[model samples]
Structures are given as structure tokens and as C-alpha cells.
Target: MSTARDVPETTGITEPPRATGLTEPPRSAGVTEPPDTPGDPAPAGGVATAGDRARPGDAVRWRRLSRRMLVIHPIQEVVRSAPALIGLLFAGSSQGGHGHIWSLVGLAVMLVVGTLRWFTTTYRVTPQYVQVRKGLIRRRVLTVPRDRIRTVDVTSHVMHRLLGLARVEVGTGRSDKKDGGALKLDALYAPEVDRLREELLHRRPAAATAPSPRRDAAAEPTTPRPTDQPDPLPVPGNEPGTEIELAALRPAWIRYGPFTMSGLVTAGVLAGFVSRIASEGNVDLLRIAPVRQVVDRVGHEALWLQVAGAVAALAVFVAVASTFGYVLAFWRFRLTRTSGGTLHVTRGLITTRATTLEERRLRGIEVSEPLLLRASGGARLIAVATGLRVGHGAQRGGSMLLPPAPREEAVTVATRVLGTSGPVTAELVPHGRAALRRRFTRALAVCGAVTAVLLGLWRWAGLPAWTWQAALLVTVAALPVAADRYRSLGHTIVAGHLVTRWGTLVRRRVALDREGIIGWNIRRSFFQRRAGLATLTATTAAGRQGYSVWDVDLGEALHIADRAIPGLLAPFLLRAGQPSDGMDPDPGTDPIVTSPGA
Candidate 1:
């Protein structure tokens, strides 16, 4: 069976997995139930833990965060408030120039609040669960069961690097919609981060929850065991698996970075920053000498020439910004498999990051290609694993298997990771004519709205005739977008995976494992119902917790779900000539299977 990092170490150390790091000396020392002394900070209750050192009274130990946070937090707040501070400084004599006074008070308040978190936050690792306690006034305590852990992410920003500090986030296999996806420990002594990560994942499942009074005579002698306990327990993460290098960033791949669209975001941020500064300073951008010169030169040029110049400038800006962001985030990116049965990703320039994902937690992966990236013949890979952050944030997308790169390279990496060529490259079954017509209808409605708005402005608002003409011409592009979106809709079931591909601006093909699907949702909008189509959404406890195949024939949607999980939907479906019992075919069997490790 494929298992998560079965090795007891987070770094993939090949130690013979152990049930208890609890040495024989401790047990033999006549310390039954881990003696509680003066410093014992708990009631005599907690779930039994499998793999950990038997340090006297702490079935778990409370650990404090590093003191270095007191410095780091205040510095971060100061930097964050710099823009606001500058604006206040320029609030000027017209308002009696007293804004600086308010800014000072604000900065002091921020510093205190930021620094207070360090003193308030406390966390600990125990046999049963990982718990974090924080919030000075509210007294919030977040607890997550250890067995559900799926990913460990460690990151160090520029300031953190200088101080030998790192932040760690432990993901508890919670869906993004759920509260408390991770328990974060900010500003830990860098080396402690490693030790903590290893300890947390080192857990092995206990042999048995209830040891029977009647022992198996034959099995007792035959299964000679260590730990000498009645149960020769099977731990969750202690299954055997080998590690291998999967993929790594190549220098040539950097050429595609500009097409990743990260640049466009950076451009927007830069523009916002510039606008904020100008507005705060009460300065007119057009009054600047360079700005005036550029405007005059462009105004005097032919209309086509002016348009071409503006496009060229914007392209240059985006390219530079994109390249810079790419290098900053992925300079030395490397993806490798560690013996612990985890996929380890390490990358970054100024702020380094290391993310470890248990292989068993991976439900599937997403191969995405935005419009520009597709045009540039590139694609990216995102791992769809439980507890693997799913958004664009740096802290979240630790699941990024590959940045934008050649489509062929992406396909190869995906094939290797998923371990099947069939699902990775199989041709998808397309949504038929009704779905196609629906796409066109939506597209035409959008174009019609835009054309109407432009015509109103040209006639009633006295705008130039060219305005409506340009809008009408631009609306025609929506037709191609509609076609592309329809063409993108397709899905197929192959090799234990349900592959669904869709989207126009960003085409995404997701290959999700059938075993991970917990349930199936059938959705039909009013328009969809009229068209005799439905959307099949596979609900899993992993990735986004849901992946949907849109605009599919109703019967086919049922077929896809049934094929994905043989008996899952059988209870709900109206089988041939059979009356509905409103329950599963097998009444005694549990609908939810707990053994797959999902």
C-alpha cells in the first residue's frame, strides 16, 4: 500500500521505524504512567502516543517560542506602516501639521500589539494532538489530531534569515473552508524547526485501541516483538517506502517566467504604490517634466503609433517585473523525494522555504495554463494534496510542483508524480452540443452589454464615434473566448483517476484519485436543467475539497460518479426497474471507508 512518510524522520533519515522512542531504560526505571512532579502542567488525561521520547511526566511537553520574535514583530509592523506614516507626515500645515502626532501614536500602538503576540503564544506537541494556545484576551486554543497531519512548511524571510529564525506551519489535513487549517509557530529558533517537524511526523499508529482479554495463542509466540507490549502496533506514518528525485528547476525554464502572469500582478502593485505616494504628497503626475514630455510626444504621434508605443511600454514593464518576481521566488527551486515517503520542495532567493508533503495525502495534481502562458507554450503544476495550501499566497502554494515551464516538461513531471501515463495524457470525453450553445449564449450576452454601454456613452455622453466602434470590434473577441471555454470542457475516467479539464482564461486539467473521493454532488442550474445538463462535483477531504465537471449530460454525470466510486452513489441512484430503498444496497456496511488513509 502507498503510505505517507513511513520513515520516522522528517528529513528522510533511514532509521528502522520505532513504535516508541520511549527507551526501555525509562520504562524499567519504575516510572509507571509517567510520574507527575511539581512542574507537571496537566490533568492525567491525553490519548496514548506511539513514537516519542519517554521524558518522565510529559506524554507531551509544552514548548515556548523564541524570544527573538520580540524584535522581529516590531520591525515587521514598522515596515508595514511606513506608507501610512509617510502620508501622515505630509498631512501638512493646512490641517495644522498635527498628523505626525497621530502617526506616532499609531506606530506605538502597532508595535505593542505585534510584540504582544510573542509573549502570549504558546504551543506543544503531544502523543495525540498538536495544540497551540494564544490570544491574550480571547484565550484561543487550537488543537489538531497528529494522525491527520499532511504537510509541514518552514519558511524564513530576509529578516528571519539574518537572525537564524524560521517560521513553521503544521497542516492538519483540514479543507480550506474549515477553520484552523494550520497551527503556526512564528519565529522559532531555526534548528528547533527541524526537530519539531521530525517529532510531529514521527508518530506511529498504536498497535490496538483495545487489547483483548483472550490472547491468540499461536499468534502471540509467532509474532515475537519489540516494545514487548501486547499489541505489535501498526503506526500510521511508519510504512516502508523509497524516495527518488522527481523533478527540478532548469535554467532554461526561467525563459518562461515572464509568461507566468506574476508580472501583471507586480505591475498592478507598483502602479498602486505610485498612486498612493502621489495622492498622499498631493503632487500632479502630469506636471512632472518627464511625464509632460512623454505625454506631448505621444499626443503628437499618429493614433496607431500612439497605441503601439503604449502597448510596447506596458509589455516591457510587465516582462521586467515578471522576471524579477520569478527569480525572487524560484531561483534555486528543486523538487525531490525523501526516504520518509514525502515530496520535499525547496526554493527561493532572499527568503528560503522548505515544504514536505506526505505522498499518501496527495489526491491528485493540477496542471494549469493561463491564456498568455498557453500562448507561450508553457504550463504549471499544483499538487492537490490535503493540507497542501491551495491559493496564490507564498505561504499557501507550497504545493506548487512546477512553475511555468514548457508544456512537455510539465506533462512529464505530472506523469512521473502520478505514476501513470494513461490518466496523465489520456484523451478526455468532451461535453456535447448543448454545452457548446450555452457557452455562446453567455458570451453574446456579455458582449451585448459592453456594446450597449459604449453606444450610450458615444451618443448621450458625446464621446467620439471611435469609442463604440472599438468596443464592438473588441466584443467580437468574446466569441473566440466562448469557443475556447467550450473546447476546454472535457473529462475522462482512467487508471484510478478522474481527469477533468476546463476554463478559458486559465485552463486547468486536474487528475484526482478515485480513492480520495468521499462523496458526489450533482448540481443543475436553471439554465443547465433546461439544457438537460448537470455538473458533477466530486467532494473529497483533500485539495479544494471539491472538483467539478461542468455542463455534462445528467445521465453521464451519474455514470462518472458511479464509476469513480463503485458503490458510493449506488444507494442514491434509481437502478434498472428497482424501487428506491433510500439507503445503501448493503445496510450493514459503513458508507465511509476509514482504511484508505484519506
Candidate 2:
């Protein structure tokens, strides 16, 4: 067997070896293998060893990012701050003295920062970890274990596309509170990013065998046979099996965008912009001839009619804006399954983004149906996977699988993506009367408090008496909401999946894999205890980390936990009439409580 001292510190090779159909002579017992020369071709049919790829040395060499980054980084910075730059220019113009100089100073500062960031940063990939070093005054080095890496996302904006560059981000499930885990390389050659992604995410097949030389017949009699050896662990970047197209954008799906809340969001943004511009005393849109004409035309109309017309106009504006925004974001959306069970999603019209997620990291799937979309039998699917919560923003790192597709289509896509044949929609077990009572009680308390406040305002603050009627209407509205909330609470287990359903206006049904659950947490508040209800939380490394089956019976919760993972909760459970005191149960034959449903 070769020893540690036999390995070379550095290979001194310029490029990776490729298959060229030639074989090198075996090295002598203690001799280190020489690195392949710059122009040398690799032996065909001969696989390169780990040492041939990453050269182990006393100190790993630091590799700088592609020099193209110097130009790309500054352009990215300027583009990101273009709106701020425009505002600064406007402010400077108004101030008159040296405003242009200040703008130039700001640009200079950004250029300097971008330049320094490029020069100081260096990264190196080794067998065990991917390391990055940066900072001019206070040096910082970030090392991420290869095994911990969960996702490799490639994103490119217009500027990046123009320069033939892409940004690569490697994520581990853990979020970095300060700099979002810091494994991002801002600019690299697009092809290199693709190679890096494959290197980081691919899982080699277990059946692959390394090349071996035959031993002498005399010594072979005492040696173990190759067939008796266990399979080797999978290696990254060794195999990408096949690619399968899963979903793609359809023209018909565009109609669903107007029904989504995205329209309301766009309307709110427009309203805010108009309000800001008006507040600045720069331009009053209402003073325009067309606007004045419309206002005058509606001036003589009934108050209710005028209000109705304005609402109609706003709705039209919102719908149009939302449709445009949606098309821009998902114009050419495509979901594809690549080799080694990885999912690839590519979308966006102007600035395209490609996200890769390994199948092993996925815990479950969530189907969300808002009130409007549910009426049309439409739903959105989100992947409950690890490494999705890397950033602190609401974006949540590319969890969306289907955006407002037909419910049936969404289910079909989900089943295919999860590699399961069972019915995606399982028979749900309702959280009985106790949950309903809790919902009603909470709703009643909220309505009563609001009514009391309105009564106070009406009496002492001299508000109109109609406010009391409005308060009554609000109180009555809570009943339907409470009823819907109660109707939405349900959970079930089917075909190794835990199906959980909840919510009213935005109903969500999640199908979580039983094997993915790592732990169980049973929680009961004072109110829940009084009602004999307990919340059973299934903790997993993926998909929001923990999903709760709320307001379940105490006995049912324990039974569910025990049934989900047979031996996990067995030791903690005790048989009836055994003991009131807690004691460790026998490991070999523990009795588990089971109901008919279980």
C-alpha cells in the first residue's frame, strides 16, 4: 500500500486531464506521479485519481477570480445603484454648487471599492473544502466543506451577459447572519461556472470501479476477491446520468398572473411612486390636460359612481402592470431534471437565472391556493428543500416549482419531481371540534376588542354612530373566517408521506416525506392542554426545518410520531398501567401504542 509520503505536494499542471485513449506506465512503489504537462493529452480509458485533479501541498495555492471580474464588478455596482445615481444627480442639480463633483466622487469611490475587492479576493478548491480569502485591511477566509454544499445557483444580469460572465453561489443550509454564508464568486467565465456547478453537485454512481492491476497467481490465493468488497461512496462531478424536461412556460398560463396578488403589489408600488413624486413638488400628474379632462368629466357623477369608476381604473392598471411584470420574470421558464437527480430551473426574459437543486436535499412539496386562484382551480407549488433559506430576504432562494398552474398539473409536476407514484392528494384527517372552538374563541376576542375601541371613539371622540354598525359588520365577518380556518386544519399520512393542510384565504397542503423527519417536538400551551390538544412538530433538515400538525389530540400526536418513524419514539413511550414515573423502556421489545387510523 502507498503511504502519505509517496504523494506529491504539487502537480504543477496548467489544465485538467482529458481522455485521449493512451495509458501511462504504472509508477514504481514509492515514486510520486508526475503532473501532466500543459499540452499533454490524458490516457483514454484511464480515469484520473483525486490527486491528479487537486494537488495536495504544504500550503494550498490561492487562485484569483478571472481578470474579467475587474470590469464586470464595477459595471454591476453601477447598474445596481443607477436609480440612486439618478436621484443624486437630481439633488445635485437642485443644490447647484459642486453637485456634479459629488456624483463623480461617489462613482470614484465605487470604482475603487470594486477594484480593491477584485485584487484582494482569492479562492482555492481542495479535496475537503472550498476556501475563499479576501479583505485588504482585515483579511477574511471562508472555508466550506464539500459535503455540506447543497445548492449551486448561477445568475446573470444584462451586464454579465454582455461580458460573457456569470455569478456563482454555493449554499449550505446554514444562513450567515452577517454576509449570507459568504461562498459567492461574483464574476467568472460562464462555462467555468457550469463546470464548477457540476463539480460541486454531481454524485458519482456507486457501481463504478477503479482501475486495478492483476496480482501474481501465488499471492492471489491468500488475497481477498474484488467481488467481496463493499461498494465505494459516491464522488462529486463523476457522473451526470441523464437530463429530463419536467415543465416549461405555456402561453395560456399568462392569464393566471392577473388573479395573483402580484397585481396588487404592482399597483401599490405605482401608487407609492406617484405619492412620492407629488410630495417632492416636482410634477403633479393631476395637472396634465388629459388627467384634468377625465377629472372634470367625472366631477358631476354620483359620489358612489365616481368611487366605482376610480376603483375600476385602478384594477385595470394593476392587472396590466402585473401581467407585464409576470411575463418579464417568467417569460421562458423551464424546469429540467439533470443527471444525479438534480433539478434545474431557468427563467426570466431580461436577466435570466438558473438554479440547481439536488434531489436528496428535498424534504417535501407545498401546494398553495390563494382565494382567487383556488376559485379557478389553480395552485402554486414550492419545493421544501434544504439550502433554500440561505438569504434573509423573502425571495427564499428559488423554492418555486410551478407558478399558478392548474391544480391537477401542479400535482402531476410535483409527483414527477418527487419521484413518487402515490396520489399527491391524500385523505386528510380533520382536527376535530376542539380546534374549531379555539379558532372561534380567538376570532371573538379580536372582534370584541376592536368593537370596544370603536365604541370608545364613537362616544368620547365624537365619531359617527354609523361606526357602531361598521363594528357590528366587522364582528360578523370574523365568524366566516373562523369557520374557514377550522375547515382548513387537517393532516394525514399516506404512502410514506405526511400530508398537512391549513389556512383559509391562502390554503396550503404540504406533502412531506416520512424518512426526512429527523426529530419530533410535542408542544402544548395552557389552552391546548385544557382542550387535550397538542401540536406535533416534525423537524427535518429541509423545507422550513419544521412543520407542525396543529391541535391534534395528545394521544394521537404521540401515536403519529411513533407511527411515522417506528423505533424513534418507541423508547420514550410507556405502556398503560406500567408506571406514572418516567423511565427508559427496554430497547429490544418496546410496546408501541397504535390506533385504528395508525
Candidate 3:
């Protein structure tokens, strides 16, 4: 793993002889003299040449590759709709005296222009950056530094695969905009794709000696990459194919509960159906409008129709649920650790995602439990990484990997990937006596409001008086309180980390590294303070969306704050989180230790 940068400080490794293929033109043509010895290439930031003059072979190679460009997609995309294409033709003919010639001529001109433009578009790799050349009428050149390139993804659709080609997308810390990238090479051969990637990564020997520190840092950074060394290999135990088994799947109910798209679809359909039924006198026998029309045309309304509709809706719901489950759970499902202490993950359905995370990026580990999951001894495990950006408008890039895991399996997996970290400890925040009163009061208010609404509706519309809505209202109001009680969560501060746990029906455990925390806030509304409760928020460099907690006990919260804040804020306060940027330990507190270990 001794990169060009890592050339021994004591004695540098001599460069290998220049490859014959590299010495012909650019370097030989008066730019500079070749190394006295054939070997000994310059290192990063040093000038090197490949002969002076551009060779005929280089010109041929460039032309051959550039000529392979097939089509410019944006033009096709804009005119792909059959109706739109047809309308363009019709509109042209209508404006041009209704002759078919104008329409035909317009289409031919469009195709020819598009093809010519496509032929002009070219993307190339230079040692320092990716060069994009495009435009027929107005030539344009765009360059993206290799290090700024965050993701290099290759994909093939049926047509592309049949053509023995794949599309390569380059994402450069720009997943924010709708079109968040600079260049793409569609219809490139597999070998070419690999070569391009290697070149982009500075993997070629010529590239090896001049690796850009910026690109190296961006690709798989921890701290700032050393300005003068080759990439380092992984520590002994972590290697590819080490086979990190995922945490076991949470219990079936929890696994398939709240977060599953199926649940959302089911709830949505049910709500829609209920609303429609309550509003209209009759329920549609079939959700399919066309089918419903046909059935109604035949004057059919029977018990069977209602049953059929319910069955059809159920089938649709299941189909949607199953598809979504597979997409979110199994999409690109791969687990691998590179030889360089990097955890590589590639997953996603429509837009495949790839992440190469340095082990050092991990902040802590999180195990989540929904109500059903807690009951079933199941938990979803997530690695809380320090440098990951979350949510839209995130200032950085990286994401929390959510893999469903069984409780026991999750613990084991955490031990393996996260390196011997103890459980988080924070002060307990059990709902106090007043919490009970508050919960009941909330429930009563909901019930009273529901009764008033129902009474008013019944009087105005002469609608059937049903006890079900009243029952539903009562349940909705009480559910949260019941859930909160069951969760009876607690938080603790320990050894520079915040550990949080809650959820009676489904228990969840989370740990946040104090070093990774970006900012802290304590909030208490009048009602919350009166109830002797408050919420504590913790932020990280990633962004604001989900980096904080919502509610915890005020007393426990303060104690946890006392232990955690100084360490969390020390980063901003004194540039503390930096590897070499150290700070004095928090004073006047017991060594931060989890309650169990304590």
C-alpha cells in the first residue's frame, strides 16, 4: 500500500523503466529530456512527459474511441414521447401548407443534427482530471478533478447489455442538484470502463506515481490523506470476503411493520376507501375505473362485488409491498471490506448507490426497535458514521446504512465492524408522575373534540350515527401515550458518547460518538417544562435533518449534557476532533462510563 506519496521517507523506491507505449510523442517532442536512466519517473506534483510530439497512433486511438459515440440522449429524451413527436410533425405540416414534406424534412433534420452533435461529444481522462468535450456548433470543454469525483458507477439496461456496453456515471460530491454530475460515458465496452476507472483512480503505473492527494482523500478519506504516499493497505484482519453476516432480521411483525412501504400503502388505501365510503352512499365495486364502469354498465351490485373489490385491492397492496420490500432490502445487496479498511456497500433499486467508507468514518453503532420488533427480539442495526451527510441540502456526502438484523446478530456484527465499543450510557428519563396526567388529559381532549365533530356532522348531513369513528378517535389519542409509556426510554452519557434507548413495544438503542457531534441544543416548551420534561438536540457535521434527538428527561438530559457537551463542542471550541487537535478532558465529572460497566 505504499503509494507514490508513501515513498519511503528514508530511501525512496526507484521508478520502473518507462513503458515503450508511454515514451513516443508528447515527451520526446522538445518538452524535456527523458530521465538519464530509462527508469525513475517523477512523483506526484513533479512534471513528467510521454515524449514530445503527438503520435499518429495516439491520434488513431483517440479517433477510434471518439467515433464510437452512438447518440446524444437528451435530444432523444426530449422527443421520445410518441405523441409529442407526432405533434411536432403535425404542427410543422400545418404551418407549412399541410404538406407531408415539411414534416419529413423536419424529422430528418432533427435526427441528422442530433447524430452529428453526438459524434462531437467526447470524454477523456488526463492524469489530473476528467476532460469532457462536447458541442457541434459551440464547442465546450469541462474538467472535473479526479479527487472531486466521488462515485464512479456503471450500469447496463437490456439494450446496453445487448450492445456489449455500459453507462458510466461520475458523481462529484454533487448529489444535491437534479442533474448533479458532469459527464457520462454510455455504451462503453466493459474493458474500457475498467480502464477508465483505473485511470481515474490513478491505478495505472504512470498514474501510480502521480496520484492526486485531493482525489485520494475524497474517494476514501479519514483524516487528510498524506500528501506524499501511496494508498495504504488494510490492517491484518479486515479484508475482502471476510464475510460479515448481517444482524438477523428483526421479528416478522417489526420487520414488516411501520417503515415497510406495504404498511404505508395499506394504510393509505384503507384511509382512502373509508373516506370514500363515508362520503358516498355506495363503494366502488372495483378500484379500476374502467372495470368499475363496465361492471356498472351491466348493472351488477351484489355481495360478491364487494368481496371481489376487497380481494383485488388486497392483491394490489401485496404486490406493491413485495416489490418495495425487495428493492429496499435486497437492492445491490453486497457486503465487502476492501484490503484497505474500507467498508464497501452498493445498494439501491432505481439509482444504484455505492459507498466506500473508511473504517475511521464510523462514529458509533445504532440498533433500532419498532414496537413489534422489540417484542420479537429483532433490531435494525446502523453504523453511525462521522462524515456522512444526511437529508436534502446536506453539506456533505455519505449515508447511514440500514440493514435489518436480529438482536443477537446485530450485537455480534457491531462487535466485528465497530471494534470493541461498550454500550452507551446516559441518564434515565422515565415518564414522571405528571406525564401520566398529561397523557390522560391529551386523550380526553381528543375524545371531546371527536364527539363534538361527530355530533355536528350527524346533525347537518343526516349521516348514519356510527360508534366506530368515535372508537377510532379514542384509540388514536391514547395510542401515543400508551406507546410512550411502553417505550419508557432512557439516555446515558459514557466515555465520550451518548447512548439512547426506548420503545416498549419495539425497543431501540442508539449510540452517538461525542467527537462526531456537531452542535447541541436544549429545548423546553412551557407545557413541557411544566411537565418537568425537555428535549435535547445533538448535531453533527453531516447536517441538521436527523442528527439530533427529540425528547428526553430534563434531569437526565442535563446530567448527560454535563458529561457529553464539552466533548461534543470541543471540536468547534478548539478544533478538537482533528486527529492531532487535542483538548483537556471534561472536568468535575466522573469518568464517562456506561451504567452497566460502572
The regions of model 2 sitting more than 4 angstroms off are: 1-67, 80-96, 175-178, 203-238, 390-396, 421-423, 571-598
After superposing candidate 1 on the true structure, give the runs of residues whose Cα lies further than 4 Å from its correct spot: 1-60, 83-117, 135-139, 176-180, 204-243, 392-395, 449-468, 571-598
Residue lDDT tens for model 1, 406-437: 99989998997887877769999999998999
- List model 3 lDDT by residue over 1-598, tens digit each: 1101222212322221223343243332221111221121221111223321222111111211222334434345436544445666667666766546655656676777656755775554543455455567665555565545544555555445544555676545442334424356664665555445433432312253454433422332122233223234343531232223332233342343333333445557877977776555355557768977866765566778777887777666765674465455345544444444455555544444445554555677667665555555655555565334444311123343445445566566665565554653235446556555655566666776677777777879675677546655676757675557534656666656676665454465667777767666767777767776667777653222234333555655555665786554333232334322222344434366343553
Clashing pairs in 2: 21-44, 22-44
Q: Residue 108, candidate 2: how far off, in angstroms?
A: 3.0
Model 3 gets an lDDT of: 0.49
lDDT of 1: 0.71
Tens digits of lDDT, candidate 2, 418-440? 77745366678898998889989
Which residue pairs come into collision in candidate 1?
Answer: 5-340, 205-235, 205-236, 207-233
Clash count, one per candidate: 4, 2, 37
- Give the candidate number with the greatest TM-score: 2
Report the C-alpha displacement of residue 32, candidate 3, in angstroms: 20
Order of all candidates by lDDT, from best down to worst? 1, 2, 3
